[model samples]
Structures are given as C-alpha cells and as structure tokens.
Target chain A: MLERVDKAKKQIHNTVDALGRSVNIMEVCGTHTVAIFRSGIRSALPESVKLLSGPGCPVCVTDQGYIDTVMDLAAREDCLIATYGDMIRVPGKNGSLETMNRSNVHVVLSSDDAVQLACAHPDKTVVFVAVGFETTTPATAVAVMTAEKMDLSNFCILSAHKLVVPAMQALLSDTKNKIDAFLCPGHVSVIIGSDAYRPVVEQFSRPCVVAGFEPVQVMEGIAEICRQLADESPQVKSLYSAVVTAQGNTRAWELIEAYFEPYDGPWRGLGCIPNGTLRLKRQYKRFDALVRFGIEEIPKEEPNGCLCGQVLCGLINPPQCGLFDAVCTPDTPVGPCMVSSEGACSAWYKYGRRGKVHHD
Target chain B: MCLAVPARIVELMDDRGVADAMGNRWSVRTTLLPDVQVGDIVLIHAGFAIATVDEEEARKTWELFAEIAEFQERQAPSSKEEGTV
Candidate 1:
C-alpha cells in the first residue's frame, strides 16, 4: 500500500513538473474540497497546477429566500422542522435554526430520522427541510416514499436540491474563472452516471473526471485531468470506476424521477438557473411543503453587501468580498456561503486562506 | 462536496437496507443494487446505496489506512510511538 502511495505521489510530482505552464484545476464537489484540505494535498502540488474550489456545497448554494421560508415554517405552531445539521445554523431573515433550536427545529443526521420523527409525532406535521445535491436527494425521496407507503400525511419535504450538470454549465459560462478541467462531484455521478457529463465535455471542450471522495481517488482524478489537459485531449473520464458507471445507478434515478422534477431554483450566489433545481413532483404534491403549508411567495431577500452569489458562481473569490472575514465569520454568518461548512468561503476562512492566490 | 463511504448492509427491508458506516447505523435505500444482500458491502451517499462495493477492495483500502497510521506512528518521537493508534 505504501508502495502504491509512493508511486502515485511520484506520478503526481512528475505530472506537475512536466506541465510547466500554470494549469487551473477546479474540483466541483464540496466533499472533495474538505478531503483536499484535510489530506493537505494542495501543499503537495506545485504552484504551476493550482486547484480551486467551486459551487459544490449543497447547503451553501441554498438561497436566502429558501432559508427564510424554512424559518417561516419553523415558526409555525403545528409544524416540527426537520433538517440536515448543516442547514441548522444558516441565518434566515429573522433567525436561524440554531437560534430556533429551543423553539421547534430539530437537526437530524439523515432524512430517515425525519421520517421517524413524523411517525413518532403523528399529531404534528413534520416538515423535513430537504436541501442537497443529487447525492442527498435520494434520502428525501425514500422519506417521501415511506410516508406514502405508510399513508402518513404528517410528513412533508421542503426541497432545495440543485442539479450538478446545469450548475457546471453556469460555471463554464462565467468569464472570471477559466477552469482548465473539472473534478466532477462523485455522488451526483453515482445517480446521474459518468456519461451524464458528456454534454459538457462535448460542448465546452473540458475534461470532467468523476471521482470518489477518497483522498487517493481525488488525487488520481486530478492526475487524470492533467493527463488529458497536457495532451490537449478533453473527455469525460471516471477515476472512481469501482463505484461510478457510464450509465450510473438506474434504480436511484427511478426513485428520484418518481419523486421530484427539475425546476428553476435560485442558488444563493448563482441567481436562478433554468431547470437547475429539483421540486417535488405534482403527483406527490400532498408532500410538497409550499403547497401543503400554503406558503408560496417568499419575498426575495439578499444579504446586505454580501457577494455570496458571485462567490458561488466562481466570478469572485471569498476574500474579495468586504464582508467575508470581518462581518461574516462562521458564528455570525450573513450569507449561506459562510453558513455551510462545505462552502468555498467557509472552507477558505475555516482552513487558512492566508496565502491563497485569489483568481478574479 | 461529494461525501460517500462504504458500508455493509446489516439488514434488508424491501428496497431499503440498514447499513453500518464507521459505526453509524444508516437507513439506506439499496434500490441501486438489485442483487445486494444483507451482508453485502455497498458505497452509500445521502442515505442511498449508490453502488455495490467489492469487499476485497474495501479491505485493501482499510489496510492502506492502517499502514499509513502505523508508519506515522513509527515516525513519531520515541515517547509518542507507544501511544500510536
């Protein structure tokens, strides 16, 4: 195993040395960002091949209005708010779930926990604050399926899931970040398939490598992209071939299709991308939070002078925003970027961004 | 961030499986793996089994982590080597 690590590290070093010019490699997965930082891989790489973070954090990309709506539901008397731990601290217009911790909102590690909460409290309405990319959507689907299967009307989902491919397209369109290649989100590819990125590769002429969350897998993915870029060949590749397939998991897709449909959703920093978000399908409208709670029009609200939107779209770096370190620390977060642990800004601030060369 | 981990299915309930990941009991939907059994190892993400994992591969990966820990232990100061995991 040590021999394998040595070989891979030597290969990486060789690749970095061979590619004399500066190469910008962007990892478009939040988990990858954490792994990269945790493994201290960035320090191992040469300054020539720079690795940058992208809009891969599900909770970070959730718009302010969506958080406000969830808060609105949390304030209700008959409602019990259920959500992933990451979304709990995200500040809405009034207060965050952390502030409402003593009030009603309950943070659960999994969506099944929310389903159990609904089952246990049949008298109360359990609003599972569903927020994630495709990786986390299946759990919400299972929860919805469970509610339907057991004929439990007490459970509902407030979905804020954003699709990966559309978001990737938006990133490519941006002029600020000239990403040479992309390390695509692994979990999304597990459901959508490695070939799901074929369109982006064909159209934008960028190499997309679908990789697992393992440190080795991530490094290998970067290596794969460098190999493609250095040779001037761009294509969709799978470094995590053990898990990800060309067509992906069919049944997971079926479950997702059965539950939700793509819709225009407002990303916290990326504005609204057409069909970039997932909403509960009409057939399961009874489980839809907006319809069931009759809370449709959430007045749009942006943070005061926060460039979370631009940060999310990769148009600007985190520190470029005046409010980043001074006004928007983790404890007193003003935007979703500062709130989510996987967020690029949160990653930068949490892990030292002192010497990072801010692009654009 | 793409956070995924390998887990062994402890129990199967229709399309759902109760899997254990790093000592955590996760109620995972295993619809992705049609042939997955109670003892089968699977890669899970967002409460769903995204792929069937090869136990041999998992053991190899764990062995790698264990090896790294051992090496790091040996590299630690003489007094701290005894305290290595």
Candidate 2:
C-alpha cells in the first residue's frame, strides 16, 4: 500500500510538472478536508498543485439567519429543538444554542432520535433542525416517513438542507476564485451518483472526481485530477466505486424528492443560491417546523472579524484571519467555520496548522 | 456533515438491522436498500443504509492501481536509459 501511495504521489508530481502551471483543485466536502489535513496529504503534494476547501461543511455554510431562527425556536417555552451535535455551538446574533442555557435543546445523533423524542413528548412540539447535503437528505426523508408512519403529528423538521452541485456552480461562476478542477464529495456521490457531476464537467469544463475518505484514495483522486488536467480533458470520474455507482441510489433520490423540493436558500458566505435549498414538500407541510411555530427568519450578519466567508471560497486560509488563533480557537469559536469539527478552520486548528503560512 | 462508512451487516430484523465495522456495531435501517442481507457490506450514513457496495467495481479500481504500478515500472527503465545515453 505504501508503494502504491508513493507511485500515486510520483504520478501527481509528474503530471503537475508537465502542466508547468499551478493546478488548483477544490475539495467540496468537509470530511475530505479533515482527511486530507489529518493524513498530511497537503504537505506531500507538489508545490504546483494546491487544494482548497469549498462550501461543503453544511454547518459552516448555513446562513446566520438560519442559526438565529433555530435559536429563536429553542427559546420558545413549548418548543423542543433537536439538532446534530455540531450545530449546538454555531454562534447566532444573540448566542449559540449551547450558551443560551436552553434546556429544550437536545443534541441528537440522527433524525431518528429526534423522531423518538417527539414520540416520547406527546404534548410539546419537537422540531428537528435538519441540515446536510444529499448524503444526509435520505436519512431526513426516512425520518419524515417514519414520523408519518407512526402518526407522530407533533414532530416536524426545520429543513436547512443544501444541495452540492448548485453550490459548485455558484463557486465556479465566481471569477475571483480560479478552480481548475473539483474533488467531489464521496458520500453525496453515493446518492446523487458520479454522473450527477456531468453537468458540472460539461458546463464548466472542469474535471470532477468523487473520492473516498481514505488517504490513498484521496491521493489517487488528486492524481486522477492532475492527469485529467495534463491531458486537457475535463470529465467526471469516481474513484470510490466501492460505494458509489454511475447512477447512485435511485430509491434514496426518489425518497428525497418525494419529501422535499428545492428552494432558493441563503448561505453564510455565498448568498442565496438558485435551487440551493431544500424545503418540505406540500404533502409534508404539516411536519414543517417553520410553518408550525410561525417562526419568521430574521436577517443576521456574520460576526466581526470572521473570515469564514473568504475562507469557504478558498480565497484565504484560516491563519490569514487575524481572529483565527488569537480569539477564534475551537474551544470558543466565534465563527461557524471554527465551530464544526469538519470546518476548514477546525481541521487546520486541530492539525496544528494555525500559525503556519498557507497558500492564497 | 457527509461522513459515512462501509460496514458489513451482521444481523437483520426486518427493515431494521445492525452493521459492524472494525469491532463497533451500529443500528442501521436497510429501508433504502431493502435487498441487502446479512454479510453484505452497505454504505451507512446517519443510521441508515444508503447503498450496497459494488464488489466488482471495487476490484476494477484495485486493478487500475496495478496498471499504474506496471506503467511506472515501464517508465523507470526508459528514463534511466535516456540518462545513460
């Protein structure tokens, strides 16, 4: 395995050298960002090749308004708010769900847990803060289906789910960041399939490779991207064939479509993207927490000195921000990027790369 | 937020099942891929089995690595010969 990794590294180096120019590849998955940092793959790459973290972390990309809305829901005396663990720390305009001292806020492992909480509390309305990409949308769909099957009317979801491909298009359309290719999210590809990126490759003429979370898989995916650039042929490839197929999981997609529909939603760094957000379908409207509680979304601004927007765009690294290490450590994260474990800032801080100089 | 893992289904009770990966067991629902049975490896995320692993394609990916190794071997001797010349 070590020999194969060395060969892949050599191939990447050769391909980059042949190109004779900088090849910037953006990884659109937070798990990939952490895996790359933890495996020290960034340092091992050729200087001509650069890896940038994109808007893949769902929590980091979630708009400040969304957080404030969730916090407001948590504040209601009759409402029970259940969310994933990472979301509890994301700062809103007033404070985070954790710091607000709200006893109704519960950290759940899955949407199923939230459904169970609703079943247990028959009187109080349980609102599950659903947030993730296509990879996690199926689970939310299943949770919604389970709630319907069990006739749990008190259970509802505040959907903050975002689509991956639309956001990729948003990034590519931005002239400021010059991304040569993309490292597609592995788990998302399992649901949407490798062919889902066909539009991305066709429209933008950028190579997209669906990669696994393993170190060698990531290196191989990069090597493949470099090879594509060297050949001047932009295409979609899947290196994670063990789990991902050309068509992906059709049942999961069908379930998601049945329960949710695309809507223009706001992102933290990237503003409202066309068809970037997912909302409950008409049939599932009763389970919509936003409608049930009459919660209105209040526009909120990102905290001062938080460069999470620029960092998400790959325009700057975490250390480039003055607040990164000095005031924005993981223990007390002022920004959403530092709060989520999968966020680029959190990964950089945990891997001891906070003070070092990074690429532009 | 999109972290998922491949785990082998150790036990199945109707639609709900338990999968084991590296000694840890998780309760995963196989409703998405209901055809999955015990001993089959499935890609699990957020307490659900999203897809089954394609063993054939996985083998093909491994073969591609072997081909990469063979290509590297072929290129090494020619580059060395060029240096000597």
Predict model 1's lDDT versus the native: 0.77
Error of 2 at A250 (Å): 0.6
Each candidate's chain A: what TM-score? Answer: 0.92, 0.97
A329-358 per-residue lDDT for model 1 (tens digits):
876788877777677777667554634443
**Minimal lDDT window, size 10, model 2 chain B:** B76-85
User: At residue A205, what lDDT does model 1 achieve?
Assistant: 93
Native A-B contacts reproduced, model 2? 0.59
User: What TM-score would each prediction reach against the true structure?
Assistant: 0.88, 0.91
Query: How much does each candidate deviate at the interface, measured as C-alpha RMSD after superposition?
Result: 7.8, 14.6
Residues A1-360 of candidate 2 have per-residue lDDT tens digits of 788789999999998988899999999998889778766788889877888989999899999988988988898898899988878888887778889988899888778888999989999999999998997788889999999999998999988899999999998889997799999998889899999999999999999999987788999999999999999999999998777899999999999999999998888888888999999999899999888877777546789989999889888888889999899988779998898878999877876463332455
Which stretches of candidate 1 lie above 4 Å from their native place? A1-20, A299-301, A353-360, B22-27, B60-85
| Residue A63's lDDT in candidate 1 | 78
